[model samples]
Target: MRIYLYILAGLSSALIGWNIGQFFLTDIGLFKEFPEVTLFPCIAISLACGMVMNEIFISNPTRPKLSWRIAKTPLLIAVGLGTLAGLISGGISQILFLPQIRFPTPIVRIIGWLLIGASVGLAEGLTWRWHSMEAGDPKRFWQRFKVSVLGASTASLFAAAIFELIRTTLGAMPAEFKGVEDPLGFSILGLLLGLTFSITNSPSYLGALRAGTGFEYTGENYEDIDPNLQPVNKSSPCIDKSILKFVNNGDAYEIEEGLSIQLPGTGTVRIGSAVKKANIYIPGLPLHVADLELKNRDAILKPNRVAFNCIEVNGERLTSGDDIRRLKHNYVLTFYSEKKDGIKEPKIYRFVYYNRFLDPQA
Candidate 1:
């Protein structure tokens, strides 16, 4: 299952990278003469990045010789993965898009595939390994994912802005399009587009940012989120392997920092800590309890409207009608009570989880 997920992620990343590359290439006029080279690299990079995304984000011990061997395996696999992704993406683009778009010949296509895979592998591997996404909790999975995407997309947008600026200086970009080609304009536009791709694809660049920087998104869709908002760190869902076994609470309940929860007809819950957040996840629910309420200090709890849908952190709330604003490293959560008929006192349950750095780094 894990291996398959990695492959799927790699394929999607390749497609997104190719599409983003094509968008830029078209603006730069590379679409006309060297269309082949323009997109191949993007596909290759995305796949390569995807191939190693798991190792990149999850905690693992560093052994030089072992690391080398693992690294080699992904690189070797990337060749094939890149080729497959490129061909599929290119074919889909040609079939569905404008007639003016050109598809590389069979031989050229294969060569392009190889190059793209190699380049994407190198770029993604280096970046993801160096900077990985951290998963504070399941509630934070998507939030961190978006943050990672934003980081990579920001990088991509910056690159495009620089390119446009250079072109303007060289008078390569026409004066008529000058307004359209303004660095700020290009950057804004590229940022939106890159964000769209990142969200849809969940590439390692975005994932890496989430892990390394502790960034995340609380918004529904990344493109709709404010650029001025603070950046989110991409987080991985999997706990570090070395620590995973020890921290095993047998899946009772879990929560992380900077999260808030609201329970229907009850109250609110918020949880966060100083220095670092806790890793929170819930296993089985007690049979007696029907639902629960979680809210922050200031939130007004409504009745029968909100059901405990697990956990919420910072600005990302889980249940419907739950609202989140900003993500803070520090947070608090209040778990509400559900009582049955004839029961006077609300039955409370205990939540268990692992705290900061219980196990040594792998």
Candidate 2:
């Protein structure tokens, strides 16, 4: 359902863009004097399509405040790529339509539109790869490259075929509707391009965090949320392993710092205070506070050394060396400072996990 929304967003934006381009190019005679200026409309249409699709792809519900700002970079990248594609295709189309060239009109139009679709897909794939790199998963570079190439090729072929079919079908309409065929065909072309990109880039999992204090903290009280934190609503290429460190700031417990790292497919994730060794490091915890093993979406936590006294799962304190807890969706893991008394309350950090695939509302 969420996936469908992305496709719809892309389609609607592109359709509107194409119509606006048509109005300027045909109705207003914006480029009548200079035939070379016609490419402006192509660039405009691609910009609208690419920006809208990229924005939707990067938007996340959890960090609503930062969505637009965060999307700016990726959106620009996609738009630039799309615009380049538009120029290339539009140029070729113009050359093909010259009186000297005797190419079939339909074939020329198909080739132009197909390049637009393929460029958008390629942009999306490259943006996804950029995201993976930022998330510290450079190993998946080849995988992403393959997916992008395949997606772009498929989009190009499908766009060429579909655009021609729509135009042909619409051409068969009554004489009065003849003028409307181009606009209608453009709308469907936009829709197909968007659908192709969205389907190819959907993610496998979505992840988010919830505050365990039962109250939302705002106004600079909590530590700045990690910029790399996965958006709760957006599709995630891979699961994230995060470590959040907190401190009692006298008034209330507040986050001090946080890190979101890519989770390994098979291995023990060591959690401790040693920045040099632990995958997740909490300031005051023992050098080896715990070892977390992920199995089939479940997190199995095993306390190490003196960690039995410092860790709590779902509010129950760890009591013995043999005790191991399995956590799934909505589970809470709390770490407490061993100190008894001080100017501030004992430091408490809460980590909440939500699986968006199982609970989309989260």
Candidate 3:
């Protein structure tokens, strides 16, 4: 399912990119005027698709959302550099085909515009997708450069078709810039852009597990179930069954991140900063919830095998989205209810791992 989603995302990005490029050229009066293809409509559709895909694939629930304020500088630098490279590449191709002769009325202009579109597409790929980073090998700087170069080359190959289709000529000598776009000039473009993207978005590249789960609250109150009034029933059946099972089995569980649905609840199940597989959810907790796969020897599950890690305590993040995090052995997760909204913290629910699989009350 993960692989399929990634594949779907890749195809979606490509389709979005292709349309964005076509619209860019179309806006400035290129692309042989195909009927029913207006620049504005294409731009709108392409932008919409790009945004949808971006949210689906690039947006991380655990991490703070990247605002336009944060992204603006990166976007500006990327677009500017991309446009410049496109122009340079276009000029080179023109020199090769139109060597010693000048074109009439902006055939060069057409190529320049088309290259800018190609450049933008490459920037999108480099900025968001490149993540493989090996630390401290002849140092981090050179390693990052290598990875960016590889990723950029791959991205540019896919993006080159955008420039190739522009169909420009000088005095009827067809510009054979197709060869130059993919393997050579675009590689250089990718190299530069990749370096820029890596340096600018370094936070994402480090790829460490985020610490401190987000917490929040609800306006509604369940007074009879008041955590302050009543003691937390650790053995409550409503406590997330799937997650508690890990604790029961005596395996260490780390909440690497992301899940929803507090499963099998008669009233409300308190799942603190953990995602449960419940068919129903009545939110009033102060913790982020998520279901995810975390592999580590420190965990109690079959060393390195996928296992469930849910905490049955109510929690809600005040900022960002839900974010459940790494766990410690025999720890109590405290969170607040809707009634406790004004209070900064939630009630506590503790889990004790019983080696049911290993012992029978000896």
Candidate 4:
């Protein structure tokens, strides 16, 4: 049953994590008599139990080799990322945390980094990747990061709770002290490091969907699969989505002030240079946008420095405004304060009723 596979995955990850951590803990002399305790034997038994559970209830009859390879990528990525972080953190410790205390030399620091990275890669990666594969596409970098945060937080809380329970049961919790190592206390240092990993280097929800839909990595980036799911472009507002609606019989049209002006309710704005040399200005509108249709369908705002004699609605000028009441229909704006010619060119400014903040479903 899939439930058994899930159980086996969790138990295997946790036991393996604990076992690998035990060797490091023992090395640091934190648990001096760890060998004498039944913990090692208990761990071995748990591993056996997981293996049997998988073999009996969750064995795959088809494409075992391919499945194994697919599963291995997460493990590899985890190791690579973990090792990188440990070294960086250890090196920074010398500069940041070590000045307050005596510290290790360069070679010793390198060794420490390797140990930390390896432990974290093995422990956190196994658990998170195995359990969270359903949440999104592993290739979706942001989705991965979000799921990683959730998974790491869960694991940390579980590990910390278990550690605290043991401490309470044995009455061996370390006393509060300044800069003193408690020989008997145990900390899931990997969990702390994993939190950072999840935040910085995770995949996305689409990754889970990709994995679910039988998507293969093929040695390519995960995002390569979903061309339709690409993130919205952020560099220019021109590519940004616009909201324009037709109001009654009115239409959208463009004005010739180096900006595209849509007719009231008319969706099309005439894209061209203004006929008059006079500049145009709109006031009292926040987040104002002066959309200009450049050649080749590119829409943009007017250059502010070239049209500097204007105030903003809400930090930005109104190329679009929420209240269509006064702005709706067709209104002409007159430019040029200097009265040279008796004839004045009117720039048409049309307002369309659009809720820029409207919910799509609503």
TM-score of each: 0.29, 0.60, 0.31, 0.28
Please identify model 3 stretches exceeding 4 Å from their true place.
1-57, 61-66, 99-145, 158-362
* TM-score result, candidate 4: 0.28
Per-residue CA lDDT of model 3 for 90-152, tens digit only, reads 444455345366664244433443344344444444433222112212344454445544444
Residue 155 deviation, candidate 1, in Å? 2.5
- lDDT string for model 2 (40-60, tens) is 345434634453445344445
Off by over 4 Å in 1: 1-34, 37-39, 46-61, 68-137, 172-246, 249-361
Clashes of each: 50, 0, 23, 30
Q: Rank the candidates by lDDT, best first.
A: 2, 1, 3, 4
lDDT of each: 0.37, 0.56, 0.34, 0.32
Flag regions of model 4 displaced more than 4 Å: 20-61, 84-141, 172-362
Q: What local lDDT score does residue 161 receive in model 2, on the 0 to 100 scale?
A: 75
Write down the worst ten-residue block by lDDT for model 3.
353-362
Tell me the tens digit of each residue's lDDT in model 1 across 243-323: 221222313111222222211222332221111222222212211212222233222322223444323333334465344
Q: Between prediction 1 and prediction 3, which has the larger lDDT?
A: 1
